[model samples]
Target: MSQRPTQRCHDYVQEVFAQEDEILRTVRQQTAAHGMPQISLEPNEAKLLQLLVRLCSAERVIEVGALAGYSGICIARALPERGRLITIELSSLHADVARAHFKLAGLADKVTVRQGAGMEVLPTLAADGPYDLMFIDADKGNYANYLDWAAENLRLGGAVVADNAFWGGSIFNPQTDDDQAMVAFNRKLAAHPQFDSTIIEVGDGIALGVKTK
Candidate 1:
């Protein structure tokens, strides 16, 4: 595989989707079908989501945000036959759009969406124990809290992926009070004994954590 998706990879993604399974094709069309923000996963991000899900053979997954259902669709599509995905979305509007996309993707059954504050829902939902994978892409101020919860709730050998951790190349500067919260969370995630961490500068930013027992 190409180390990082550049022009060639972009072309490859188009090619991959040229013959994409009908579900993904429908998803792509639906995402393009609506005038949603470009919050959907980029090619590299989508590839990584797919890879992470396949690697874990994730039976259960949780997403902290469901912006248009772009990332959720990619992640959920990778699950096993018995797998399930629960996405927490803050907006009823986004949730409505995402529900339509999920239905179009033929994943309406496998994907469950809850609209509310993620923090309130997290404590209740995470108690079920050991979600195989979780993605954090919600408000930046809550990054640390989410990581703390994910550490406690995610299964051993599972993974937690955070997007926009870099905040559009802003982390390199002296951490500002505004973005410092996100930076602080990154340090906490790195130092935490339970996880093996890596930071990669993909779109915005992505941090991957492999949970250790």
Candidate 2:
């Protein structure tokens, strides 16, 4: 069997297809400098997000996590001139940092950084939907809940993309609530009658589902 993607493979893809620009680099640096967890999506993964956004012709996007705006920049860049993105972050500190980065990327006009728990803020956004796409990358335990919301709010033919689908390989033998939640999230998304879904083996893993019915 072919070997799974390794550090070298990631490095090669980063150099060729996912090189970070100055704005994105600064987001990463400032995220660490602010003592936040370095859990932002890999550059390659961000690139995939960009592709997915464009593929779905997404104009209104919802990001369940805004970690310093690294991924938000990528998602926003792929949007049309009038497109908009609303990203949610639990920490005020992280939200502030992301707002700064979004402004730095000259995307403040196109992005809104919401500071609150995902479930709390998500309901308030219903008036903005059904959104074209929704990206979930926040608390593991609430992934399925977020998916449920997406299923209800996403437009027909829209998409729901979740990060950490593999949960660091723990899905196979879930030992914690978070791991079990991810396992259930993956299963539910894949089996949902209204959606067609699959796991794309990128950084950690990416679960992508499209609303079909």
Candidate 3:
């Protein structure tokens, strides 16, 4: 039998992410129109990004994936007046589309899309940054490396968000490669002393880790 969402969960999500401005709304429409997959962050994820931005009041932020520029726009919209977001996208073509969306959203000044493999791109990204926040939403096989690099780059008390952790609920299964990677990553994070994390089921799943020590 399929599980169903509780009424409280439904209501809570709606109440939390109800606020949407014209720019954000426009970007959402554009993502759909681009003929790309619905790879954008959902309303709940956007709300989480909004809350995290408010909490950090971040001047510098980094994101591992820039899929259609959806989450980047949401996060960029929340940054402080002078805040900036550095987003990495694997595909150059997607980078171009993302740039167009940022222009449409009027967030070009606050967000930059870097085109390259994150493993190669992340190291060269500002070494001075003990960034306030790091978001990893890239290829699943790279999660372990991404977490390692993010841990080194993030400031103490900073947060790292790893998306698609539950992998469409396949995380409990033992056979699939994606599930295995997620399971291993979950274990790595849970055992690491540097971070305290909670697995949250929003959209698919997100793992929020707070840097410690």
Candidate 4:
């Protein structure tokens, strides 16, 4: 029998394990004030991202989306002093906002905000790898493409983590193109021969795969 978390359980986890600091709170609030989409990861999910980074001992990280730098801060915090993070954002305004947040989080030295579409920026980043971790949270339609890139760029033990794996429960019966794309991405990640993958029932679901080849 599968046991899902209750609202109270979630609250407890947030209170204990995912409390937001002043810097993170400011990032979230300022992003909304700047009229950007308030779609960055929740505190719990941010904590999970940090945990995944530390679990994998990730030092070189690539973030496909840099929305106000909320998740970037979390990922950067988990990295060692010599760690580096390259985050991509399509909107210049959002990229600027994320850069400010990264500075505020005291992670400016650790992060590089690349202002471009994921597909366009990813190719330019190949020489920087093989990266230790790649986090996907950008356009849903291009998720599979990003995973394909990760497969080639990540080291044998590196990890690929994608958000919105459940697509708000739409993966069960995909109707829209985005839904279908997510389903296909999930299936491909699960069946990929070089990676061991699983979906963690976090906020919106997080699909995690570790390369073994």
Candidate 5:
């Protein structure tokens, strides 16, 4: 028998720090059944997102990628009754799956699934205003562009949380376009003067930036 240390640690984290219920399990199954990519955040990362939402008192949230409503549901569950979450997806099929999951999770009212390229759709959301938190998990090539929008749209003290920041450890020596884009995104966030940021060593990696001015 082969024992994998990382797998063991992952199981331990799931057991002790990030337990998922039936709803989350069903969401995972649905996404897989629909042929969506298996790239949702880990259980611990999902819990961390919930905590961050609470920590920031986020009432208006935007998610750049809604693969199968897993992250959307995770963040929506953290909201107060009146809070709203707008999630954008590039694939209409994925959007449909996410909407169904949101309905099953009884978050249909709280979550709005928009199907379109994020850059094109984001501009239409400008009037939604000064969001409390923005979570970017879309195409890596556009991560920095998303940050640009967040910087302009999020209110002072609002947060921008980006997933897949490490690009599967490619930040050190990026070989592909996506990996190179992530490296650029990381550097841009770390050096930007208007926002205070840090990269959390979670799942892949999560870059968190708070607008200061």
Candidate 6:
């Protein structure tokens, strides 16, 4: 069967630049089997996150919105042996599954699954700051809030990376609440004085920002 252009390009990119291993495959399958949302992240996006972690030499990572530990595993895989990852998940079911996956991946010792609303849990993490990197992929409406927290808690040189910044191209539609929030978040991220930022077309869209102050 002929593949669509997008799929063809994606497949070629995966072939040339990305690799997905068995751990990630099992994580994906388990999410589906457990009736969790299949919005973990694209393979290339996961690889990009790993690359970003390495690029920043990140030792401590804070991940907001861990659906099933897929992305957390990706981040954890890039960390050094002694590095740590603290992920916030609202759903207890998701958190439980994520914990199991982390254990299966031998990352239970390095990863901490905090179950609660990201915004509520974020304040408690302040004492754990300043983190090396913060990855946001939670509720779209809280994008700005998450970025704000990242700006304050991340170290001066740390980076804040967010997924779904384009809101499925609905930023132009002007109808969805999520789209409106995303538009505001994108603008704020680029204009925020403490960070230099830009959004890239990866997976829906990814906002990358570095704390300059």
Best of the candidates, TM-score: 4
Could you list the CA RMSD of all candidates, in the order they appear? 3.2, 1.2, 2.8, 0.9, 3.3, 3.3
lDDT per model, in order?
0.82, 0.95, 0.83, 0.95, 0.93, 0.92
- What digit string (tens of lDDT, one per residue) describes model 6 on residues 115-151? 9999999999999789999999999899899988998
- Candidate 5 residues 1-213, lDDT tens each? 896458778778889989989999999988889888988988988988989999899999999999999999999999999999999999999999999999999999999999999999999999979899999999999999999999999999999999998888998988999989999999999998879999997788889999998
Question: Any runs in candidate 1 off by more than 4 Å, and if so which?
Answer: 1-35, 174-178
Candidate 4 Cα lDDT to native: 0.95
Error of 3 at 70 (Å): 1.3
The candidate, 3 or 4, that scores higher on TM-score is 4
Q: Candidate 6: lDDT over CA atoms?
A: 0.92
102-211, model 1: which lDDT tens digit per residue? 88878899999999878988988966878999899888888888999889999998999999877776777846774887778899989999999988656667889999
Candidate 4 backbone collisions, by pair: none
Instruction: TM-score each candidate.
Output: 0.86, 0.96, 0.90, 0.98, 0.95, 0.95
Please provide, for model 2 over 1-213, each residue's C-alpha lDDT reduced to its tens digit, 9 standing for 90 to 100. Answer: 998778898899999999999998899999999999999999989999999999999999999999899999999999999999999999999999999999999999999999999999999999878999999999998998999999999999999999999999999999999999999999999899989999999988999999998
Query: Which rank order by lDDT, best down to worst?
Result: 4, 2, 5, 6, 3, 1
> Global CA lDDT of candidate 3, please?
0.83
After superposing all C-alphas onto the true structure, candidate 3 shows an RMSD in angstroms of 2.8
Question: After superposition, which runs of candidate 3 have C-alpha atoms over 4 Å from their true positions?
Answer: 1-8
Instruction: Report the Cα lDDT for residue 123, model 1.
Output: 89
